[model samples]
Target chain A: MSADLSIVRGKQTLGQRILGFFSRSVVNIILIVVAIFWLIPSVGLFLSSLRTVGDSSSSGWWTIFLEPTRITLENYANLLSNPTITGSFWNTIVIAVPTTILVVLIGSLAGYAFAWMEFPGRDWLLIAVIVLLAVPIQVALIPLAQMFGAIGIFGSVLGVILFHIAFGLPFAIFLMRNFFMQIPSELLEAARLDGASDLRIFFTVVLPLGLPAVASLAIFQFLWTWNDMLVALLFSNSQSQPLTVAIQSQLRQFGANIDVLSTGAFISMIIPLIVFFAFQRYFVQALLAGSQR
Target chain B: MTQTVVTPAARETGRGDADRLSRRSRRRAILIALAFLAPALVILGALVVYPIVYTLVRSLFDASGSTFVGPENYIEMFRRESTFTAIRNNVIWVIVAPVACTVLGLVFAVLMDKIRWSTAFKLIIFMPMAISMLAAGVIFRMMFQESPQLGVVNAGVVAVHDIFVDEAAYPGANIRPDSGFAKISGAIVSDDAVNDGSTVDVPLIGIRADSLPDDVVNAQTAAPARAGEITGTVWLDFVRGGGGVNGVIDSSEAGLEGIRVEAVDNAGNVVASATTDAEGRYTITDLEPGEYVIALPPSNFDQGYQGVSWLGEAFITGVIILSYVWIWAGFAMIMIASGLSAIDRSLQEAARMDGANEWQVFRRITAPLLSPVIVVVFVTLIINVLKIFDLVYVIPPGVSKPAANVIAVEMWTVSFGGGNDQGLGSALALLLLLLVLPSMIINVRRFREERSR
Candidate 1:
């Protein structure tokens, strides 16, 4: 895309080029200023995480610029050593992994069915999925909480994972179904005519063809479950809380120990950020797909 | 015609067999589809659909979910002040946060197109979308602390404030006991009025020596007043080593600079006023000979400008919304930026080639074209803010929780955050659903329309 723009720019005459340069520079300056404005809070969090407790409370994070030696790894070390912090981090992995796997697995199967297979009330069920996409999780929270309690999975990581999967499926199925709709029916029909069973055709043809959608869906589900707070907060108990819930618990404590808070928040943030940037293409593609839908 | 004449019985038999076989396969396909859909359908039914129905049913029940009390929870929710506050704040959140985010997003998206480092700029702007609301709440809470020393925002605010207006010079300054000064309505006034030619001494205490401004000079005694002029020295009476005499300037004492000293007449009007210098010396020249009470007005002892109480009851909701916008604006930006990229650039170029200015091009050609995407972003945000929970639940301090409450947080509080009233919580949840339903319907319809197209 940018290559095309540069090629277009090369054709401009000198006067037009100069005028464009000035306008672009003005835009550049504005963007830089806004970018810095956007970066301040995260920078503050990162810088504070490197500072000592007393230093964080006594001065703003920007003060570290004046005193370079104030930065330390003590906060991260302390946080890593804490059982609750490490435990919650592990719990996040436990919850997010299963939720992502189950959502993708179940959602793809259902999506394939909704997209290609013949069934009674197929259109009606698809419409139900569309409507379910609009259902806020709040409507289900209380009853689910009770249901979890009754089923003895309440406050367990399994419960949180289950809840995530349940809520995640609607969107997952919706996204996967939409993506699958674009797959040429001839491919599926050819596999079926070759004596491939329905499941075999799905695995042999549809799943392979739908890899991009699958990748994006997986990344989206992983990030959603990882960054989730409300579901984890309500569904999980102290032992099962994710990093988000853990950090929130710390936030509620008096005096808001910045060293711990920043460290925990940064820790909670870095993983998803790593995942996002590592899979940046898939992530953005998924976001655009999700929004366009 | 002769060839087909005797084939009716054979054709009927063959047609029946094909029909029966087709029916069997159709039934098999139905079974297969259901088999594939079973897991998702069961989970969705059990976790999503059933729970929604159960919540609706549970809302009518009492706290224990046993006894029926229809409409009572809804009535009680309306009656409660906190519920009203929650609803009001939710309305404010819905109205303000989304528009703020969308407008900012649109601006960033449009401007970003002209820049060279657009990707980096978009990354920074959209980075917050990756952060959890809990983390965002923590960051914002720390960022908006009241003290300039701690919070970067208040530090900037205080710096800007001091540039425009002078801070109180001698905040928390107080007169010594038995110093011939009386505390009158927060001001330190001389008990005895002085003639024009008389010199006065106003010795104050209560300021820590270390807290004084760095440029403060040692205390100095005032010179004798000449006729038609009054002179005075206002200095800290407390010495560093505690050896100074009460109400007397000591060599070790520091001057209270910039203290506004007013001389009031018997009729209570300020006759003359002067500010103390670095040496705590002030001279009221051209004063009348009549008796006048010298006063250190309360403004001198006023606590200097502390930055805004962002987490206080008055501003908590706004602060929460701001934090929300901070987190979600990037989502809006990225979405809108994608939309902006998808727009037909030729239309914009043609508009520009015409006599249209940039603003006109944007307003007429760009915006109308982008309205669908904008509405999608807007409606999505509306639905999002309606169920806003994390920042509202986390950002506000306990004292301002009520003020910052939205229906989601309120629902959580009632159900689990120590309220222990699930019925009321269920009602609030239902209310939230009802509130979100319209936007959801709009969003679903938009999705359907987009898919159809």
Candidate 2:
């Protein structure tokens, strides 16, 4: 009886260890498969960009492995040389930078007002802002384009900038307000007791402590404006069109030079990815904040 | 205005100071609040609120905004076929795309939880989210291009297809006009029948030289018929630079490889059949001495495998949705992964400790805990796909724009994309807003709930 019990006890540990090993392998396989599926299209595009025109038309991106010598930077060089592409790249910068600055400025200010200041109708206004967060940007497009046309800023980078700032405000304000509301009241009271004016308190105390929120807000605004297609499409004219619109015009239904497109797209995507990596910490925090909201 | 001069000492003596100080401070606070809120309000009011209100009012008017249409545009939106198609496509997108993306994300998130390379997996998967929709659209559009030479997907398919059932080498290659054969019921049938011991020469033209398979060799005339076999040479009648005589196997002509030649009797029954070899030579031995119709079936001239016509009218919406999923699935994964990590590990451990299998633990403990986050991601995606103008507007060709049209794309087309009907666009925009409002409300409520948590 004792011998039989010892064998059964040994079998249980062995089974558990085997179960653990099998589960681990299953987990690895699943993750790897999902990873490959996600990577396939992107890898195809990247390899296509690296390929020579002759290679791209003749073979699949997968063949680059068989003959790695076929890879070249000619597509990238040629795309960068195009005057229109250069112009649009500049246009993207001109739009995204200022829009980021304005959103952070206005959001931080209004957030402070709603969170700390004593103002009647504040609660109703905050609710309105929250509701405004849900307003799809499409609802505002036609009228705003007309308004821009009426004001004579239509088809200009400035026109696009103003539109982004206008639309970006609600979410920025919501984020900033929610973030500031979490700041303990004692921090502001301590400043007030030291004779700091409201403006000084805002600039010196709140803004300093809100670096993570600001960084994330800036990253979000920059990405949204930089990656934007529709707003730029509606507002900007040919000369002022951003890279998104520019890359779009390059595409054709039949026989587009996909090599040029691949290069241009990578060029357009790299900056946002850089910005994302630079502020990845803040970016993830912002996503968390956005989800909570 | 009452007792105006009674508080002259209250300002300095701390007598009745509380009331005056409180009232003044209250007024000052309002002024400061307004000062701070002015920029945001102005922009939001002008660009967002004003336009929305303008769109609402404009939606009620006629195309020129000169006539009072009284919701006619709204009603007419439902009345138009293209617009109705757009609404239907939007319904499909809302129903399928989000669920696909959300489910993929949840699965990925749960899978990534047990792996050591979770960060790398997340980065690679989430990488598409970094790309612009315009770019992603371009990538998918190229990948789905119809030609195997152009699209990677078709090339992969063609490669796999070749491994299974062999594809026709001379697809769409047919007999030239006034040639020996006539096309009847899509098969090339010879007008003359031949006896069992006779030799025949069947030459086909009208296929390009480059399309010829590499194994194809110079045409060789058939040898004299043996005792009981009917033999033939099926060679390309056309030659390079057009020097070959019609219906004759010239020295330069390459053989039509792998073509099926059948011998059928008068009552339309196949007696014997043989496929052409490398030199276009074929023979059916031991045949009865009877008249036969030589037929080349239509399978010999089928249009070869072209990859999917992604931008075409039939499949544009699907391709666009696929691109959306490619981008958003990663987003869902990242969001859900964050949510999953926040789940109490001890509960999962306890469940496992209590003899529940991994799947059971996931279904019961993990899923219930992650349900709220999943709902938020799904709702967010629904809201997003509703206003999906950029991809829809960009991906489809000019002819197919109507088929792939979602409401936002329809709105743009009507107002700006040459439709020149702002009133109709505004109505469409308003309809989209109404459609999206519930999801937005749910999202905001979810946000508030999370805050309360």
Candidate 3:
């Protein structure tokens, strides 16, 4: 009887194992299918960019497998030779780099003050920062356009950068201050006891400890400025338009110029994609930390 | 060393010196902090705070900022049909996009654990987060083209359609002039009724010779009709060399196969029907000895399966919203997955060991535990969608732009997209701010709660 019971128990375990395997495979299949679905749009764009103009217009991008010779670098070559697209590529760097650096410098100082220093109405100012975090960029667009016009910087790269800095600060300061608060007060007091000035303490102690947050913020701000189109559309002129505005202008009314559009769009996308992958850890960290708070 | 014996006056004097020194240091510290914060404060005060106040003031004034409108722009914004359409589209976006992204994200996050290649899957889904809204707009715009040859979406739709439904053989075929037939309501009908045992011919024009289906054979003349039967031939009337006579089925002309021919009586009922063969000859036999109309139905001339017009006015907003959801669902997934990782595993294991299946454990344990994160994702998405502009701006064609308009686009259009009505634009901007304010408040409150903990 005991032997019979053992055999039955073994059979039951085997059946459960098979059931588990089946369910697990189902989950994997679902996830894989979903991932492919997510990838099709971008993949389609990439393939379309590689095909010659005549070929892409006549058939879907997926047909390249049937005629592999149809793919070529001609579109990329044409895109590079186009002065407008290349100029806008340069314009993107001109706008994004300064915007990132200025936001970080100014935001770190303000965040340090808010976190470590004792000043009048500190809490009220921090509350103001929090409130500003929720304010959309549209509220600032009309008035700033006027302000930039009055200052004679309208439709210039400088105007776009300044706008980005102003809007990027509140969230930057909030994020940095929160990160800075986690640093023990003892460290700052130690530096102070050694006759370090407030500036020296901030530079040596606070900034070093806040590297993760700073890195995250830098990546976040860089991508934000690089990917921005609406601000550039409203504020920048044809002479100063970034790759996004340039691409938008090229989008024809009927029958898209697939060659110019696909190539230019891919060009605009490649840099951010590289930056994102290289520092994806920090990017994801920033996203997770930003949302949790 | 000198002996120390302090008088009360000396001690009090020392205390005063120390107090004065500390007060001066306090003053200096305030100045230093101000110095650190000055640039950020100036920019924020000028750009964010001041602009908000300026927009409010501008909304109350005329477009040129010289005359006081006093809420006239607001009233005008409400009265405009475009404004109502924009508001309605925004409501649809808020209702649809966020829920779609969040639910898909949750399901993806939960199922990812079951796969060995979960990281690869996550990366693929998260890849779009790096793409700019403008690039995504361009990608989707091309993907949703109306023609199957140009758009992958339509290509797939057309392929699937062809599988279940027979395509029309001749889309643009029509009757030759004076061919004893006239197009009535898109059908080729005989101009005069014919009795049984008579022969009829429908020689069609308008189809190019090169465009004809490859299997088409040379037209064959129908044999003389037997008693109580009607016979006919439907073939391309025009010859390739341009020497064939009008309304006559020449020997060289190719037959238009699969064209349906019906014998209709006076009451318009289809009495008998036949489909043309490769030689374009169809015959109806055993008909009563009475007059009947030989007609070709409209199905024979249908432009077969043009696929969906995805960029048309009806589907424009939906396509744009689908693109938005595509870009954002990964963000939601990553966030919720992080929250999922933080939950205690033993609770889930305990539920599983207690005879619950995966769905039960998910519904009873995982979903309930993940609610806080889910709510955060949902509200964040709500805030994001309210100001959505790029996809709406780029994906729609010029004709469908009005249908896909949201409040943000409306604001831009009124002020900058050639309308030049800044007063009304400011009002629209303020309206958007008000719509987004509630979700932002919820997010800020959640931040505060998280911080206090």
TM-score of each: 0.88, 0.85, 0.87
**Candidate lDDT (C-alpha), each:** 0.86, 0.83, 0.87
Can you rank all candidates by TM-score, best first?
1, 3, 2
User: Over the stretch A1-293, how does candidate 1's per-residue lDDT look in tens digits?
Assistant: 67867877787789988998898888888888888888999999899999999888778889899999878999999999999999999999999998898999999999999999888788778778877776778888888888899999999999999999998898889889988999998888888889999999888889999999999999988988999999988899999999998888787663558888999999999998998778877877777776422
Which tens-of-lDDT digit does each residue in B252-325 have in candidate 1?
88877888889899999998899888898999988877999998889887667778898899988888888888
Which candidate gets the maximum lDDT versus the true structure? 3
Candidate 2 per-residue lDDT, tens place, A98-156, comes to 99999999999998898898888987787778777767787888888788889899999
Q: Give the per-residue lDDT digits (tens) of candidate 3, residues B1-453.
A: 112333467457778556556766887899999999999999999889999999999999888778998999999997998999999999999999999999999989988977889888888888888889999999999899998988889988988987787544576778888767899998999999999999998988888665566667898988888987888888888877689888777778887778889999888788999888889888988788889999999988776787999999999999999999899999999999999999998788778768898889999999999999889888778878988999998999898999999999999999998889999999999998888788767766776787699
Q: Which consecutive 10 residues in model 1 chain A have the weakest lDDT in total?
A: A284-293
Measured with C-alpha atoms, the lDDT of residue B3 in candidate 3 is 25
Question: What is candidate 3's CAPRI-style docking category based on DockQ?
Answer: medium
Q: Which residue runs of candidate 3 sit more than 4 Å off their true CA positions?
A: A1-12, A253-256, A291-293, B1-14, B172-193, B196-299
The global Cα lDDT (0 to 1) of model 2 is 0.83
Q: Please give the lDDT score for candidate 3.
A: 0.87
Interface RMSD of each: 1.8, 1.9, 1.9
Per-structure clash totals for the candidates: 0, 1, 0
lDDT tens digits by residue: candidate 2, B1-453: 433644666767765667776767777788889999998888888888899899999999998989989989988999999899999999999999999999999988888867888888878887777668888887787788777877777877777876675554676677777766788877889888878888877878667766677557898988888766888998888777778678878898887768888888888998888888889998877778788878888878776666567678888888899889998898898889899889888798778768999899999999999997888788778878888877887677678878898888888888888888889999999998898788767766765676679
